[model samples]
Target: MFDSRHIQTFAEVVRTGSYAATARDLGYTQPAISQQMKALERAAGTPLFVRAGRGLRLTDAGQVLARHATGILSTIATAHGQLKAITRLESGRVRVCAFPAANATLLPATVARVAAAHPGTRVELLEEEPPDSLRALREGRCDLALAFSTGHGGEATDADGDSDSDSEGGLIELPLLDDPLMVLLPAGHALAGSSRVELGELERERWIAGCRHCRGHFVAACAEAGFAPDIAFATDENLAVQELVAAGAGIALVPGMTLPLLRHTGLVARPLAPAVGRRVSAFVLEGHETAPVTALLLRTLSEAAADMERAASGSPRPEA
Candidate 1:
């Protein structure tokens, strides 16, 4: 029945040898400190201190409480250290899910960074699209999900709203970055020569759309055209989309992250006019134990993103 606050106050007063000093050090008023001490003593059903000159010294009962409290403090400190090691990466498994675009830029770099820093740690990567990534995190399928969107970036939410969907309740969403959406078109395409193109310009062009469930490609890029894309094709294969563009079959709206990974030399990359960007974020369940690893991954990806941004500005990305 010993409260942590009471024990902490008792220890502080004992260490400082005066309630006034304890109050000063802890930012508590003297009266409040005294009240807590009295409550602690009452809870223990014993006297815990005795007046010694202008200070109070431990009574026999107080000594017992101090001894127990010291152990409690030590236990708490050890637990904290354990969690720190997990963050600093002493050892553990980190499971993450990412959309294709994020995996292209963010995830690989993150994995490499985590691997080098925490060699004892293991990472499992699951590739899922935007909203589905959120679902995976809520269902406990993974520790973290790299969720994404057209503009607001990705956020992890507890999907536990109704005992029905993939998203579970008690979830935590963490924002990562807002990635600029770029144009992927065949080389020498009129739109590619320009630095950027607005979504509206392509309203009449044949569009390569993502599958129905993975609406990111269509919604983020083509939706701004103010008309649904004339879906000449629907496929998750970004490579295929680029190939089709190169073949003059159609053009596609591709994430800027994919520019560095595209190997099709016949294709050209351009930024979206008016500078549209998608938001990317990581999702985790509430009270997750792998917070350290997830944090490391998120941090590394951010660093990589900054580096990419530096290269992307005023410079065309070399074809992969």
Candidate 2:
């Protein structure tokens, strides 16, 4: 039979690199630590440790088992914390990333909910835009990523007019909502006088948008209006693009989800004349299903987006 004590001792020995060091730290004799390792190796039905460089090292199988065991330990630790939090109303931490503009709406509401539930769930929030957020997840820099996608950002496959949502590799993208791209007009630009602005009508107008990652969707949306946008400026910073528009520099496409955050009185947000918008989506690397909390966060985010849309459409949440 396997014991939690056996797992704990095996982890300690792997961490310390020597039976004697592990014994010293755990206050157990070297023989006891060795026996525990042997017991674990036998139960797992594979050799775990190998002698190397005057100390013990993990075999390939051992390293794989170690990683799984580490996660198992982490889950136990997290459950304990959550239980204590439920009792004392104190929680731990959840690391999340999002664009600066999204913080205005989603973050505030999400913070309110998590804060009320655990009262102690510390949220380590980071500011990152799409593709960057995707990269961060791939590099293990963050646990969950709040991002968006389009034809050109990352490896996206759109056949003719159909979406190959399941065709992508490297990242698993969960589309949350379709936030149409709204055209931001300069305070007193010619088209600003119109109740609605059409891209084809502004054949001579200039455009500002996010760099490569964001430019593709904005460019495609403008194309739907029957003209390529004149590239007067391009930037990844949302505020910078808005400020430039406010300065009468150029018109740009801003996602609907970020409308509330773009309170730049200097600019007016009008739906695209051709009707285009960004597809707001969440992203995570493949094979992360083992993380229960990560799944919970994804669920919470998806629910929030759905709630936002339901409120916008004046619909009620589905019956439980």
Candidate 3:
């Protein structure tokens, strides 16, 4: 393998035609320049220089190597610059896959902050729920995935429907926040004015479910409350869920992260009695958490989650 330092010295010597001149120009001793040339020539397995009347001149092999040296040096310099840029967070790309609720709230804030902090960094956003997002992370389709899981252990399912434990599935999870699920009710409903509602309180009412995983989580919660909900509609779209609840189709349970995006005047959201919610996390393939772009995105996401928590604390109620 050719050493880049030797290539640099060899190129300088080729340009100047004198070891002393090359050494002086590069702020190295003449002996050091000679040693570098020797190492470079040995690596090439050929004589790179031959005696001339008063100075050094490139032999045929040396000339060929010299012709290619320019490109090699350029490539090395370009690689160095790019690595520096990435380490400094001055340039890079972070492909993020997040669920719809986070895409509506946390993701936008995170993207804006990343752009403002690192103008040269690019963020590519993809929307997918936990199962699909986890799959994308494992398949190397995304740098990071913003996914949610029922706080219960091993509740997060992956692409193949396997449970996502802390160390299972070659994933690194960074738990961001616990997003409480709120019950969405018609504004005219008797319990709509209440500050909080129990899961059993809505068990008799028709339910509008969410994604497959969300529906499962809701069903389990309902079972814990000693009843099975009669799901009248199922969709992953938050707006549709809000609309259905507003139109008296069925009450829905939605994450707190999504409340800001749901503003139906005919609907009201109240925190669940026992505080049912999902734990939102950022998932990356093992060893990817150290990547500069991924690390930056993760930090920004943590900050955004903190901000959301602070804002929610100040005003716990979600306006209709």
TM-score of each: 0.61, 0.60, 0.67
lDDT of each: 0.70, 0.69, 0.82
Residue-pair clashes per candidate, as listed? 13, 3, 0
Q: Could you tell which candidate, 1 or 3, scores higher by TM-score?
A: 3
Model 1 segments beyond 4 Å from truth? 1-91, 151-168, 213-223, 314-320
User: How well is each residue in 4-113 modelled by candidate 1, as lDDT tens digits?
Assistant: 87888889998999999999999999999999999998998989998999999888988887888988976666456435434533356766778777777777777887
In TM-score terms, which candidate is top? 3
Cα lDDT of model 1 overall? 0.70
Residue clash pairs of candidate 3 = none
Model 2 ranges off by over 4 Å: 1-92, 152-172, 193-195, 224-226, 285-292, 310-320
lDDT of 3 at 280: 88
The alpha-carbon lDDT assigned to residue 41 of candidate 3 equals 87
- List the candidate numbers ranked by TM-score, top first: 3, 1, 2
| lDDT (tens digit, per residue) of candidate 2 on 83-161 | 4323321234456777765666676776766667656556667878665765555555555567655544342222111
Off by over 4 Å in 3: 1-91, 152-154, 159-166, 315-320
